[model samples]
Every structure is written in structure tokens, then in C-alpha cells.
Target: MQAKEELQTHARSSPAVFGYPRGRDRRGLRFVISVSLQLDSQGCLRRLQSTGHAVGPQGGNTVCAAATALMRSASRALADHSSIVISGHAPREGVLEIEVLQCGAEYHAYLRGVTDVLLRGLKDLALDEPSEVTIRQS
Candidate 1:
């Protein structure tokens, strides 16, 4: 299939799903990173979302805090880019969902980098505490 067709196919498929167990608590860090990227289309990033629930025991709270901070950081990265529409919400307990719609051509690299960093952070966290954290990708 052509590149555009392949991108459309990926967009239709289930997003890259990920979840990590929270430390000392079963409620570990969980999130979904999904993006519908297209170059020739009207926009560069058709959809971008990072959403998850982070809440457990005291240790879990720390993990959740880190997760939410990352989310906010990513949000700030795109704050001034007017071509993109961004929305994010987090409860005091640490449930966060950040969505960026219609990402433009200029910030494509920035968004990709942010996504990579987030994934790496989660993977490293899970590795450090195997028993307390679990990571799944599909």
C-alpha cells in the first residue's frame, strides 16, 4: 500500500496502548499514546492523545505526580503553536488526558520527540521496579 494508505490503515487500527503498574500499589501508571499522522493531508497530525489514570498508595502518588508533570510539560511544548488545538484535564488525584488536534507541520518533530520521551520514561520506570511496575504494549 502507499504511504498515505498505510497511515490511514494505522489510524483505523487500535492505537499503541501502554500501561505500567504503580509502585507499592496495583494502580500503577497507565496511558495510551496514539497519533494519526499524515503529511499530504490538510494537517500533519490528525490526532494526538495521551490519557491515563495514576492513583494508588503513597508510592503510587509519587509516580502519578511524575506522570502528570510530564503530561503538563508536553502540553506546554505546544502552547504557542496556534495551528494545533490542545486540550488536557487532570483531577487532583492524578488522572490525566491530553489531546492535541490538527498538529501542524512546524511542530511535528517536537510532538514526536515528546511522545518518544514519554514512552522511554515509562519503560525505564517499569524496569527499575519489575515487581511493582508492569508494562504492556500492543
Candidate 2:
């Protein structure tokens, strides 16, 4: 009974903390994929972190696959640029983290372009799959 009350309190305070919105009963939500983006002072993406899994039926989750692909593609693209110093790794399954340590001024445009595409793709995905994906940009 105490645990149930605690869960109810938590749900009321921050429903999305468990991938369900306030006033909505938790139903039909298999999982949630959270993506976080950190921007630099110049408004360029400096860090990216994605964690969680959107589990679909029959063990096939297209949302998770798509999101992971997009993040990996962006990280690979950034790593290819000589003027950009980036570090990225997948510490475990369904988790990815990338950080841009340094970037030359001349390559700012390129960096912006790549990050813009990544952000746009992620935002679009979130829009299409709101229940399965959540994004937080800082």
C-alpha cells in the first residue's frame, strides 16, 4: 500500500517521468526512449545523449532502431571532420553518448548543419512517436 501511494504521488507530480502524461492512466506504453542535446554558447550542439529502449511487439522496435541510427550517423559524421574534436561511445546496449570537446571556427557552419539535421530528425521522430520518444534540449 505504501509503495502504491508513492507511485501515485510520483505520477501526479511528474507523469512523464515514467513516459505517461498527467491525468492519463499508464496503458499500452511499452517503453520510452529519451534523447538529450546540449548546446554550446554559440548555439551549436556540443553534446548528445540517448538512453532507453522503445520496445515493440515481437521484439522488433523500429523506433529504437531509427533513433539509434540517427544518433550514430550524426556522431560518425562529426567524427570525420578534422576540425571537430568529438568523443562518443555506447557504454551499453540502448545507450549512446557523444561530446564535442573542441571545434574550429571555420567548421562551425558544418557543425551546425550536421547538428541541425540530427535535431530535426529527432524532433520529427518524437512528434510521430510521442509515447515512445521524448527529447530534452539544453
Candidate 3:
């Protein structure tokens, strides 16, 4: 009887066990990745930013990985292009920002192609994981 009482007391004091209300625990929360795009007047992508983490299992998160890969690939491609002047950085974990400083008119078509592919990949990922990813454009 005393052991049973002690067990009940322990459970009451332990948040991991019984203290959190149903559906209100931290484990029940969903982490969302937010991707933002800034477009120039000509409808060209001028900037991109991504923040947040899509929490998943112990090994890795497929949604977050896919989003990060797409953004990084786009940034690298733009930076490597001779006609595009770009700056990019990962300010912190799970955050990335890239801005286009200048671009030669001759290479605008190449920029458009890269931007289109990045945007398409991100949109597809968002569609597949509606609860884990979000996209905003400005």
C-alpha cells in the first residue's frame, strides 16, 4: 500500500509521466520550417531566407534536409555564376539567408532558371509536408 502511494506521488510530480495535459505536451507540438522569398520588380528572385526546424526522429528529418539542400544548392549556383553578384550566409542553426547584390543583364535568363528550380522544389516539398513546411513570398 505504501509503495503504491509512493508510485502515485512520483507520477504526479513527473512531467514526463502524468503532469502534462493530453495534447498539450511539448512532444505533441509540431515544428514548422518557414521559407521566404523576395522578388524584384521584374519577378526575379532577389533574396531568400529560411528558418526553423522540422523536428523528426533521432536520425534525421527528411523534410528539413530537402529544404536545406534546395536552398543551399541555389545559393551555391548563384554564387558560382560569373554574372551574378550574390551574398549568402547561415546566420545560425536552421537559418539561411541569401541576397543578390547585382546581376548582369546578359545572365538574367540563367538566374531565372535557377530561381525557378529552387522555387519549384520548395513548393513541392511544402505540398508533400504541409504541416512541416511553409513558404512566403514578398
Candidate 4:
């Protein structure tokens, strides 16, 4: 079997930290929590935004610094960038939950952000960075 397939199998069999059980619900598993100092496409100082991340001209240097910092911290934490999972939802006020999968295969880091961040109404958590990285699904 392919390496990706193998990993997927492992994840499914193993209980996920967040979201419904893999066997019970696969379709809802698409959601994720991605955090980077990177600016949203519309671009400004957005601390937390969901998939479809947009970095505009105003994205500025701070964004780079923030994202770089996040990357550095995360890389150090896991020692592997690809396996990192940036979570967006917080179960409480100014608090977040991060669940790094077994063997450090997946790293999820959660942080508190604005309503836009929670407006997406998360149902699951993905370790991978979202393509768009929007707080909510359009």
C-alpha cells in the first residue's frame, strides 16, 4: 500500500484527538485549525483566520515575522514542519486546544482569536494547512 494510504489507515484506526470517530464520520473530517502570522487574502493584521489564507500588500513585514516565528517555534516543537497541525478553534475564552497525533505524525496547535475564527463553526480538526485558510466556509 502507498505511504499516504498507510498513514491514513493508521489515523483512522487510532482515535482522533478531536472530531467524530474516523469510522463514524469521514466527510466532516475535512476541517482543520491553521494558525500562522500570515495575513488573510483581504489582508491586514488578522491573528486567526481559516483556510483560503490571503496575504495582501498590507500583509506587510510583520506577517512574515509572525509566520516565521510560528514556523520556527512549531518546527522546534515537532522538529518536523510537514507533520505540524495548526488548530483554529478554542473551546474556551482566550484558550485553545492543540492535539498532536501519535509519534508526532501530526501537530495541532490551537490559539484564541476573533469571532471570525469561530464563525466557521468547526466540526473537526485537520493537521494540514488549509488551501484558503478561512475562519468560516463561504
Best by lDDT: 2
Error of 1 at 95 (Å): 1.1
lDDT at residue 106 of model 2 (Cα atoms) = 92
Candidate 4, run of 10 with poorest lDDT: 52-61
Over 1-138, each residue of candidate 1 has an lDDT whose tens digit, in order, gives: 698786545433321211223321234334322222222232222233344433333333344455556556766776667866677665543344556665677767776676566556655655653433344442
Expressed as tens digits, the lDDT of each residue in 1-138 for candidate 2 is 999787546533433554555423255333677899999776788999887767443235577778888899989998998999999898776678999998898999889988899999999999998877899999
Superposing all C-alpha atoms, what RMSD in Å does each candidate have to the true structure?
15.3, 9.9, 9.5, 16.5
Arranged by lDDT, best first: 2, 3, 1, 4
lDDT of 1 at 119: 55
Per-prediction TM-score, please?
0.50, 0.74, 0.75, 0.21
The lowest-lDDT stretch of 10 consecutive residues in candidate 1 is 15-24
Global lDDT scores for all candidate models: 0.47, 0.78, 0.77, 0.32
lDDT of 4 at 103: 29
What lDDT, from 0 to 1, does candidate 4 have? 0.32
Scanning candidate 2 in windows of ten residues, the lowest lDDT window is 21-30
Q: Mark the 10 consecutive residues where model 3 has the least summed lDDT.
A: 11-20
> What are the runs in model 2 whose C-alpha is more than 4 Å off?
1-30, 57-59
Instruction: For model 3, give the RMSD to the true fold.
Output: 9.5
- Residue-level error in angstroms, candidate 1, position 103: 0.7
TM-score of 3: 0.75
Q: In model 4, which regions exceed 4 Å deviation?
A: 1-54, 80-99, 103-138
Q: Give the higher-TM-score candidate: 2 or 3.
A: 3
Clashes of 1: 3
